[model samples]
Target: MEIHGPGGISGPDRPELKPTEAQRPDKAASTDKVADEVNISEQAQLLEKLSQVPAVRMEKVEEIKRLIEAGEYETSERIEGAARKLLEEL
Candidate 1:
């Protein structure tokens, strides 16, 4: 058993292939790039929401730091609750 390819290289008959106009390099190279249309309404809304957010909160950071320094951050009960929730998820 044998397999015949596109040019019938393995068969008795061999057909000649002709290239079309569209397949020519000169015709292909002449094509132009098209610009895509975009909707800016959603993007503008997202930008407005992002701009409303504060860049930083030094007060919150200082409070958290103070809590840690006073040995009050992350109680054992909170740690156990978080671990139980994680175990439930798994």
Candidate 2:
């Protein structure tokens, strides 16, 4: 069976595809002299530092777990410190 169409796939009637500005090789050469810049705000840097910090301190958690298991997690000093922090927040 023979298929017949307007241009039969790569005929002269098809418009040539041109490279977009981003795809042009000269675009990169022209931009080579121009240095790319990135300025991170103080808040962004602080947030990045925060991201590097572990969300949970596993060692502290494990220590607390052990203390609680031994019925020694709650102490007068810890209670006083917690109460002080609570009052300070108010």
Candidate 3:
């Protein structure tokens, strides 16, 4: 019917609660004042730029799909051109 614990609600035996150095408001405020920084790699920056770029032409994509379906997308001339371009890049 009565509550009794280590400190007995309020007495000298009751352990005082205080914030640690890390938990103190002043210490926490100083840590919050530090400026956060972020570094983006060149590749990531390029990717972000690419994301903002307009999407590929749907008409051109549809045309290529139609040609592929008709078995006419990979002709000899196109193959030769692709080979030439690959060699040029290399």
Overlapping backbone residue pairs in candidate 2 total: 0
Off by over 4 Å in 2: 1-35
Error in Å for residue 84 of model 3: 0.4
Q: How would you encode candidate 3's per-residue C-alpha lDDT over 40-75 as one tens digit per residue? A: 999999999999987898889999999999999999
Question: Model 2, residue 2: what's the lDDT?
Answer: 40
**Model 1: runs farther than 4 Å from truth?**
1-39, 80-90
TM-score of each: 0.39, 0.57, 0.42
Clashing pairs in 2: none
> Of models 2 and 3, which has the larger TM-score?
2
lDDT for each residue of candidate 1 in 1-90, tens digit (9 for 90 to 100): 366566336545546668887776684454578889977798899999999999888899999899899999789987999999999999
lDDT of 1 at 70: 96
- Badly placed stretches (over 4 Å) of model 3 are 1-48
Error at 86, model 2, angstroms: 1.3
Candidate whose TM-score is highest: 2
* 2-89: candidate 2 lDDT, tens digit per residue: 4377655565555778999877777336534777999999999999999999999999999999999999989999999999999999
